[model samples]
Target: MGSINYDDSDVLDVLIVGAGISGINAAYRLHDELPDKKYLILENREQLGGTWDLFKYPGIRSDSDLHTFGYAFKEWTGADIAGGAEILAYLKKVAEDNGIAERIRYKSKVEAADWSTEERCWFVTVNQDGEQKNYRARFLYTCTGYYDYNKVLHAEIPGIKNFKGKVVHPQFWDLKEDDYRGKRVAVIGSGATAITLIPSMANVTKDITLVQRSPTYILSLEKYDPIAKVIRAILPKRMAAFVIRQKNIARIYASFHIFRTFPGVAKAILGRLTKSQLPSDIPLDPHFKPNYNPWDQRLCICPDGDFYTTLREGKAHIATGHIDQVTSNEIILKNGERIPCDIIVTATGLKLSVGGHIKTTVDKKTVDPSERFVWKGSMIEGLPNYALSIGYTNASWTLGSDCTAQYVVRLIKHMDKYHKSSVVPKPSNRDQLTQRPLLDLNSTYVKKAEKDLPKAATSGPWRMRTNYWYDLVQAKYGGYDDLVFA
Candidate 1:
């Protein structure tokens, strides 16, 4: 941020914020589709991989398979589940292959963005290190993700200060294994993070305990696909990957449909599968039971039953209860029980953050994000020249992000055709639409911040659906039907 100045005549066409998966995908599409327009990605971190680079824990892997989580442009030929480091490497490869590495301004965090109705542009203020800088762009795409990366979210337990052990959170893992090996540990969550950490460190640690308030659904698939191997050997790499990807995409769609439409059937089948991986002495129902239906929260994917296999081997234990307090040597439960441990892994979840907490102003008046309507789950209502890369909740994050990029490209083309500088979707029939929660999930993270989140119209083209096929049709063939561009 050293005196970086731009000429008034040379304002960027777009300022893509965050160098993570969504930002990178947007950049690729913008570069490919609108070559003449100038654009730059402003990243808060020094690295390409946002979540992958940020979390450096022992067993950090993708909750979803790599095939769909991967960009539509690239094919992931690796195992079904991908490690964090491997995912980072893949992101770097994408940046290098696309020649977008040089276009990224690392360590640049956007603090605020001011939109001028008269100028039809945005004045973005960013902080790089201690230096502050300004950038102007016609459109701002915030791909900063939906969670707070800097601060880990956890409940303040009674006597947490008294715990005389290594207290750790998965978000701030030190990337060191020596500290946890041969130590008794308790992971305080049953989500993807806890599932991942327990499996990766269970064998090395003396004993591991998964302390959960409630259970979540976990599914298992083969880490190495034998069918993929045969297909890859028979056809070209990309072609084989494409065929396998389509098959897997269909499978994912069908699985989500089954989980949502026939929750009881899904629950019974999942319970049976989970029970098969545990010892007969253990009761799988109460320990692994969830009150909500499947897909209410994300269903975690265990690579080749790694989590279940480790649990069955007596290397791990499950403790389901309320945290009464934290003692010097153990965790006191509400039921007068104690879990003694040498280390406590938080695995608690991330705080939801949108727009990077960047203050947004339109014509000097502050824009309350909650008041904005998420049009088509990308553009916000009344906030002109601004768009966000929101992804599918039921499918891979990239599936929606990739389509959103394509949709934005179409929007930009429409703007050009109309010779308009700003475009924001306004409800054609606002009275007819029922505003609902932006995220329809039972996950703790989503629930905590759902009120502060934007609203989506219930019955309109602007409404959001978790189905990838519906989104695909909406994003590809649908455009500007319910929007008013100015």
Candidate 2:
């Protein structure tokens, strides 16, 4: 879509970056809740639906259920786990249905934003259609996501350059019509991506070998939610959806609590469930069991036990070992085992691209976002009229995004009511509080870019954790006293 002139409101009240799942939610909330307030979404890519549009690999589906993965305002009518294309379609539908499409400027990559203290506004620069365009807004909100937009940080294996076979990262699966028919594929890493890729590639390839340093917890998910489907058939569309959504979200959190509170019980429950699904031939000691507790890393889900089923069919294999090096057509394990393959799929993980590489300057000075403390995992300290739409690690992502968007709207309305121009979260006792990682995710992706990420205060308004239930009330309706308004 061509960039609009934005005649109605050239100077928007808010400027949202990234048109992904988080951006779509933010836009819908902004449109319906704050009708009078003008806003526009600046997406770097040529289309909306950030993650969904980007990841086109086979079997690219949501790990989190659509009931919670979907926005609070919008209902996901698909299965519990949806494919990448379907998710993208859902995001686009949300934007189109909510009148957010027109306000989105595709290919409008925001390179830098300068905060003018005198005007109490932000001047944003976007690279659109090979031209640098400027726009001003009262507030700036980012749903750019935590991962690097440019590329996924694939693990750098030694002697990979010497390997003759094609190496590809899931972030940029360039060939749309890629066919691995009769080809031997070796996938590296044991995260969600690898789990999804193994079963998917196995269908088309002769053999698929998943090589990993360690195994991660991969659970089996029901293909559909029968209760929700039954509830929808009986109750009003929206009412049933709301009820089902709330119930599902609660179950997710409760499960998480159980895992944390009673690790042994949780392990046994998960272990038994996994063992029941796996074929008797496959061992559960190392393949299914992870040394870490559940949720230490984001638990991967195989819809209808597809991954295990693939293994049961003898179409796929999981090899847990350290990589010594890669020769022309094989991966030599450090333990002196060599796996032959024609393709190496690196599901290493993603890097944190905080704020989508958009440079932010406060009062002509560059704002080092990493140095500032994050307040409630949504907004950064010392940054006025700005918030980040980071989703939950323990639960579905949209849970946090949906509530955080509402909270942002509430904050904006409060500002308007009091005739205030800016709102910022100021630390109560910065020096006294201990700093912690911005996210508790132990995944390689979150850990890779720890240094560049913002810090959280140990105990204060500046503290943030991944709790959907806590955030629903605390983030959405929490006290505004922690914020400084001017």
Candidate 3:
């Protein structure tokens, strides 16, 4: 990676926070569209890949396929369900190929960003290597993910401290420190992490049990896409990638629409598919059934039905009930059942964070995101020249973030063409607009952070939709009626 010295007085065209998928996408777009612009990406971690680098648990992999998850400029010729390491390698390759690696500064955490209307710039404070540094930029773009990297949702299991065996959270799983070989393990929660871990550790552990208060929709997906393979074989690399990516996007859009429009029919179809994969002894009503319809919350995906295969092989087990208490060597259920194990893996969930918890101020007055509205799902209302790179919940995160990047690039081009220094969203009748949660999901993590996150209006530019097709068109041709350019 290339390093450069920057004086505090030097102002950049754009300052992007977080070197994850969204941040990388933004940097690539800026280089491709506005090569003359000076931009830098500040990553909090020492490595480039954010989530892919932080997570090191067994069976760490993408829940979404690479075709849709990967950027439009890049071609993902790997398996549909890729491991964490493979994903990280792809990100590194993208950065290296596009000369984005040199623009990234590691171990630089943004603490606060204050906007100055008089100067028409953002004064950013960063914590770098235990020392404070300052940077100035014309525009600020935040790609920090929605979750808190330093903290995990606390598991409220009673008497968890009494457990004599080693307790571990999947978020902070230490492979070398915590060994489950030939030892019984009790995996808590039924989210994506728990499902992935149960099947992955099933063979190594004496036995693994998945304990959940409620079940989540678990679907078995193919690891490799046959259609993608055929397209790649017939067409050129770029052409094949475009075709495969579009096909997957359409498929996911249609699937989500069908699930929401005809929930009863969708539920029946999902129920049958799940039942067919599981053994007869493991009933579909309690163990596999979810109270909410599909797509209500993010579905837990099991590549190649590995989770079901483990259950059928008697290597993995499931318990659906509230935890009464954790004993020295057993997890007792409220129904008076005992699950004995040597280790407890709390795969509860993640705590939601917005803007990487960076403090924002406009002229020294604190700006609360929860009170502000999101404009075009990219810029926060009343925030000048600031863009947020957030992704889709129903589809691959890259698709939504890419749309945001495209929109920001377009906005920047418009500003430069008209000799405008800054632009901020100002809805005329904000008080009359109906407010909604920015994130559409009803997931536990989202619900917990609803009041802390930015708001979405019921209609107009302030509304945020998870639809990629609509957002893509808006990004390319949407009008800036609500924006005030200065």
Q: Summarize candidate 1's per-residue lDDT along 71-142 as a digit string, tens digits.
A: 878889788788998888889888878766777888898999999989999999999776998999999999
Which candidate do you rate higher for TM-score, 1 or 2? 2
The C-alpha local distance difference test score for the whole of candidate 1 amounts to: 0.84
Please state every model's RMSD to the true fold in angstroms. Answer: 2.8, 2.3, 1.7
After superposition of all CA atoms, the RMSD between model 3 and the true structure is: 1.7
The per-model lDDT (C-alpha) reads: 0.84, 0.85, 0.91
Who is ahead in lDDT, 2 or 3?
Answer: 3
Instruction: Enumerate residue pairs that collide in model 1.
Output: none
- Considering every candidate listed, which one attains the maximal TM-score? 3
Which pairs clash in model 3? none
